[model samples]
Target chain A: MSDYMKRSFLVALWFVFLTFPLMVVKVNTLKNTVEWRWMNMLWVAIGAFVLSLLWRWALERRQLKNKEAESGEDESTRLGFGQRLLVEPKLYKPVLAVLFVATIAFPLLFDIYQTNIMVLALVFVVLGLGLNVTVGLAGLLDLGYVAFFAVGAYTYGILNSFWGIGFWTSLPIGGLMGALFGIALGFPILRLRGDYLAIVTLGFGSIAKIVIENWEEVTNGAKGIAGIPRPGFFGADMSITSATTYTYYLMILMVIFTIFITNRLKDSRIGRAWMALREDEIACVAMGVDMAKTKLGAYAFGAFWAGLVGVIFAARNTYINPNSFTFMESALVLSIVVMGGMGSIVGVIIAALVLILMPEYLRAFSEYRMLMFGAIMVLMMIFRPEGLIANVRRKYRGHKVMTEDVNA
Target chain B: MPEITNKLLEVKGLTMDFGGLRAVDTVSLDVCTGEIVALIGPNGAGKTTFFNCVTGIYKPTRGDVLVHPPAKKSQRINGFKSNRVTTIGMARTFQNIRLFQNMTVLENVMIGRHCRTTTSILGAILRGAKTMRQEQETVNRSYDLLEKVDLFKYADEFAKNLPYGAQRRLEIARAMATDPFLLLLDEPAAGMNPQETRALDELIVRVRDTEKIAILLIEHDMKLVMNISDRIYVMEYGKEIAQGGPMDIRNNPKVIEAYLGEEADA
Candidate 1:
């Protein structure tokens, strides 16, 4: 180990030990008796400092080794999966087949409880991708994205209850209604940028929730319209278990559809324009992109999926209330987009799966879940502020601009 | 497409006021078909402000600006939005290169083709034959523009990853993708070495000749301004000091004193 790093490690240890009295020590008062445990502080300081220092050392070592390896190697001859897929296009079919098989067998592989968790996670994957479009691709930093979710749920719920409309009929109307709300929300906020935009969006979400809570005549107020019909495909029994593997299958299909559209949009002109808008609004306008159209498109498209997924959420539970659509829901979707890295489509999916499922599995550790979330976020910001899975272009774009002239 | 006989751009008494100060003081200039016009001034001389007036970045406090696109009739274009200005065949590059930093080079150029193409959200979603063809053509045209600027090789690379000189060229390539009849370049040669400036000089001439587009550039680089420009409009303190050929402006004492010092013009 280098002497500088060793000294740094020692300094870290010394600083941690010095802070034990404040950071680790705890005092408790029980029935007028104040008990202090400085021994607990000493042990905690020693354990935590040692573990952290070791982690830092290992991380630095791996980074240093990676740098050396990269410096020594050339990519021209490397046959990684990306290159191999290019070399043999048929390789993708097998990969797709495997995924299809896995998705088909997922419910059977797990018990009803676990299957329910999988369905919920997949639903979030859809929601996360939808939010990803607004916050990730458009760089809009939306705080009120859940408003669209609620609108979709209510649209479906009201139509199903009053109009006797089936899921198939109301689906498009729900999405279109969600889209209209998205456009409505987007219109006023088009001129606002960054933090101001974020605040306004957060207000929009709160407004939607408050309206749902207080609008007793329409939404049944806090009681919420109960007995919302489940999605029925030609009278096939919709209820099998908690999620009803049928709804799970249908959700998987919806997720696939969302992926297809999102993927298509990402590589298209409108997608490029959205990216330009995110990167530099001035440049986007100068480049002749219709800012109004691009911004609205992002909001509508994002809200479409959110609305669709909201229908699924309402149907799956056969009930939804104002409590289901909350700020925390928006925050969870936004965090998935953030931790996945802004503009990373696949990263959002992975993050959505991990984030949604982690809490489910950690119900025993529910007390620590939020604390862990805060710690993870803080550490992420401190260490890899870029993201857990940075969009490839974003990762590559930060490479230092070349100075030497090409013609010279 | 050849440049027709009509003047491509005509700025008549364009004045821009910024809170009691006239940033651009009645700057009248004209660019004929296939001409290269240079708006030369030292820092704070309102050259960019003048460009902004014409390009719709700022609505001129007062004055009439006219644009005559080939096949289109001449029309007063004051107060048109920047995108509207672009659709009328006026595309511009920033003095500070504003290439979408996270986007690929090809994508950056492709964005410039946005106004030229016709694709709504439904078309984009469905990706029907017409939209597909338009997209493919846009890709092809962007590549062609990149090739003209000698940047086709770096098409897949992020715009921000390019060398400074390459980035400048990329900005020009992006602007050219708009298919503008009158291309406005804001200090295209800024930060460029002598060799790169010479290359840029050749590029301006080439773009004007091949594209048959009138070029207007605001530049501090006297050598480049003098070398490529058919006519130069010298401005100082928000007012035009001289408007003539390079040699004519070089000898104009007011132009010499206001901006181009004896050492600079030499």
Candidate 2:
């Protein structure tokens, strides 16, 4: 099926799923008060879902009709600036920019829930950027990057609880630990390339998880760490009780910092080195690039970011258990890089945001969403293996004056 | 004293063995300042094996490659260490053009300047003015190299996308980007037509004279070798059969026998 039709079908499935939870009879309240099921809640949810589906379907139909009408017109017509932007640009950047700006200004304009989702999106953004350095730039297949994320979380948890180290101090230390582990993981697998490398890295990740689980002396085993300290600035506690406003602002600051640094690294000499290595290691060595150092740099840098974000993740949630940093998490992050378009910073961000938020928007579809998502991935591979945002080097070009601007 | 120009690269008593078969046996040669030398021989004559030994791709079983960069003390180069070779003022192209398939044509050349790039962690983060200036200069230098080889038009094009002739020229341009004193070209005219080969001969001569870079090329084309080389070393069965100017070697009976027979030269 066409992407438009598939999207509608997904929306319909989401609508049915969203309303299913409302069928539950009675629910207990937090204050020990009796709470009765609200009648018509399912009906209302299903109605909303159907309405959303129709609205989305209508938009798609309208877009298709407009496309047909435009195609029937004369070919000699010149494209305007705004029209060119719409057709030519990858929708991710402008959309993300808008979302970013909105999230920053959200506390003033929107409610708390919107701000929370923004925080969630920001976390995935960091993870996606880190994965991009590994699976995208270095062309290393890492099916277990979240092991480093777990290391960061446990580092923060243990440091704050035992050593009295604040979140601020523990963050860098956590990143360093991640780097150490990353190097260790990278060294043994240096000789293994392609699929062999993937399997070994995956094995390393499982070993990390098993160690975390069994290391009851440090990790507290099945029961995860709780009451992890939040970040503080200028001796002012950044706890929820201190100020919700400051916490939201801090999240924004962190996301912006991640984006800026990732963008910088993506265009720098080191970034180019990574690309050279990915394209051909033999040629890269011939160009006088030290293979071991370059590969290690990717591992260390990627793990560092994941580690840093894990620190924030621990601080934000106030609780983190071993179960949270599973292979599924790594798979989700890897998929974001894959679906976005490998070796693209902007592409990963879009993938993270879309893939992360998809379940949230359609709560009911969360269960079967993965199945449909897998199907989409399969179809994408068959049709556009370049990912959702194809031709990262340049956008598609139509056979008109409109072609020049989009491609550029 | 003829200036007593220093030897940049010296290969002494080099031997490569494939099990019991000795490909290159005790072959020694010196490449001094500003000379175009050709290593010519019949197929399976160990010309390439000798080139590989000197370029640090293959460790000789019993010999040393001493590279002295214009008054610097000599240092031994180990095998399969390309970075060391590049650092010691040597750059070489493979018989099979090994350009990065996905990278841009400009990127391929810019990678040659990797050894010269000296940016700090902070510099990369801020992309300091110096870094920008250096990067621009590197780009400019790469463009100049490409222009020298007449491939400036395909600067942004992917390396693999170029036509075969352009790819060969690009390989030469990439080698030139390293600013090496010795540029090794392995079978550069291997698949070229007569017209292209003629252009390559002129290009090589121009590069030798104008760039002041010493070149050691391996070419099967006798016409190319005879016309361009200041000196040619003829090889047979892993040993240097004869080494002299093209005319002297051309008239040598040993070279004649290696090619046809002893009676042909007589």
Candidate 3:
């Protein structure tokens, strides 16, 4: 190898080494609290970093070589299927469906102990799909989306426990409450832009948690609301003694419903409005799309899905505390959207499952879990920043404003 | 088509102010039954702002825009608020092309039909017969529009992948899909080559003639504007300096000054 090449390899090796220490420091800090230690956590993190860096380096090197090759050769030929699938359509349904089905079915069919884990995964999927409408399609970043989820859960829990409402009846109320608050939250932040909007949303989510925690009369304070009854499908009540079967079917129903609604919205005029707004609000408005109405619609619809899921969560667990729906929960859901590929439904589903299930799979390395999660997210941001699907839809008819002179 | 009538659109004293920088100042214009009126201006001449104001994007600082439907159509717009201009009978394109990048070229046009489609949430969910028919018709109309734009082969393609000129054409098709009586095209010939511009001129003429739709076009292409327009309005620094037939606009000393600077008028 040439001198420059040797220097680059050493630099890559150095960067990989640096990441290991960072992981070690994080692992140590987390270990102080959780007391769950796996001997290989640090090694695995380091190995992943090295492998990722090497893969990236190899790709970069190949790209550079290709660039050189293309300088003397024709590069206009259409790419092969494998090239298209790997580079752009990595999150395409056919390629991703197997992993997604496995994720949904794994906890149900095989590991009963991890049923709660799947519940959480499915919850994030609902949340991601919810946020996807606002953030992915509409280009509205809501850091406080968890607030709506909390509202839905609490609304259902409080109504069911006090008013003796059934789980099914409470579902709508939860969705309504979520939509109401989503609208409520959206209105105040409508005029805000970018980071300012994000901050306000973050604050909104925190406020929801605080309200749930402090409102002892309604929510039972930090002790949280308990004995939140599970749903009875076809008048047959579900109990924990049944080992999560009823909830599984209910979750499947919800998953299908969320997917259906989201898909419909994605293809509809309203969906186009959202995308147009995302691309360029000024252009969208000029196209006769009512910006306020379209944005409000996204917020409302996203909240409804989140709220519905929240109700299911409360029902499935038969308990909920303010602690359960914290800012972290919101962050986790947002991360799923980001990791899955912001606008790809299948990507989001897989991302939610992988992130949710990874913790369970590494229960032995509990202390390093959050650290590893953070590392994966950071790595993803650096490398596969588009999330798993990354705006790779076959034909995007969404609005885009070309700033270049149209008269040119 | 029903008997075409007078006063398709009326804009009176439309103005826009972005923090005391008046973008469009007291710009009043009109498009009457099936006529092509051109808004010609230099760069930063506020033609787009005028378009935005008429489309209800910017609540005009001070203006009244009224649409008198083609007589046979009842006052279907009576109870509606005046500021919501497009719901009445107007549709517009941007100075820059804006097509939803993730959707198919066909789907992009369907979005323009939002105001007309009566498909309810239930209809959408169930794919009710009427809604399905409407959707099929919409798809067909989108195809027809693509074919007219000579972009039928690109119907299934993502709008983002289309070449620049094709994208501009797609935007026009999308705007037309709204079934508007009046179409506002902002800088429609901006990125087009001479051949494309010539074709666009012909297309614009055909659209006016065949569809019987009045067009208010904002174009910097002087040749195309002078060729296609029945009447022209020249504006500079947010104000209309000249308004008349192509010859009047071309010969006006003040219009020349606005474009070629003060020395030309002197």
Best prediction by lDDT: 1
Count steric clashes of candidate 1: 0
- Tens digits of per-residue lDDT, candidate 1, A1-408, equal 466556656766676677766765555545655456666666665676566667677678868855865786532234445335434559867876898999999887877787777878888899888988887888888888889999989988889878788887878888888889999999999989998999999999999999999998888889997898778878666455734777888889998998888877877778888899999998789878888889999999899888888888888778889999999999888888888778776667878998999999889999999898887777666555555656654211111122223334
Task: State the C-alpha lDDT per candidate.
Answer: 0.84, 0.78, 0.77
Ranking by lDDT: 1, 2, 3
Tens digits of lDDT, candidate 2, A1-408: 366456655665675566645553445566766454555555655565566666676666767855865677521123333334434558546965897687767777756566666667778888888888887888888988999998898999999888888988988898888888888888987767899988988888888889888998889887988888667777874445344455667767876787788667766667777888888776677777778888888898889888888888888778988888889898889888888778766667778888888878878887898897897677567544556553233211113324444778
lDDT of each residue in A63-142, candidate 3, tens digit only: 78567756754232343343366456554557668866875666557655667667777878888888888888888998
lDDT of 2 by residue, B1-266 (tens): 65335677777888899899999988887778888899998999998888778777777888888887775777888575776787677888878888877777877888888778876445777998999877777777887888899887677677877888889998888888888889999999989999999999999998889998899999999999999998888899999889999999998889989988667845
DockQ values for all predictions? 0.51, 0.23, 0.18
lDDT of 2 at A196: 96
Q: Which stretches of candidate 3 lie over 4 Å from their true place?
A: A1-5, A8-111, A233-241, A390-408, B1-5, B72-83, B262-266
What digit string (tens of lDDT, one per residue) describes model 1 on residues B33-61?
Answer: 88999999889999999998899889998
Off by over 4 Å in 2: A1-97, A106-117, A233-248, A390-408, B1-5, B18-21, B236-239, B248-266
Chain B vs. true chain B: TM-score per candidate:
0.95, 0.93, 0.91
- Reference-based TM-score of each model: 0.90, 0.80, 0.83
CAPRI quality of model 3: incorrect
Clashing pairs in 1: none
Lowest lDDT 10-residue stretch of candidate 1 chain B = B257-266
Q: Of the pair 2 and 3, which is ahead by lDDT?
A: 2
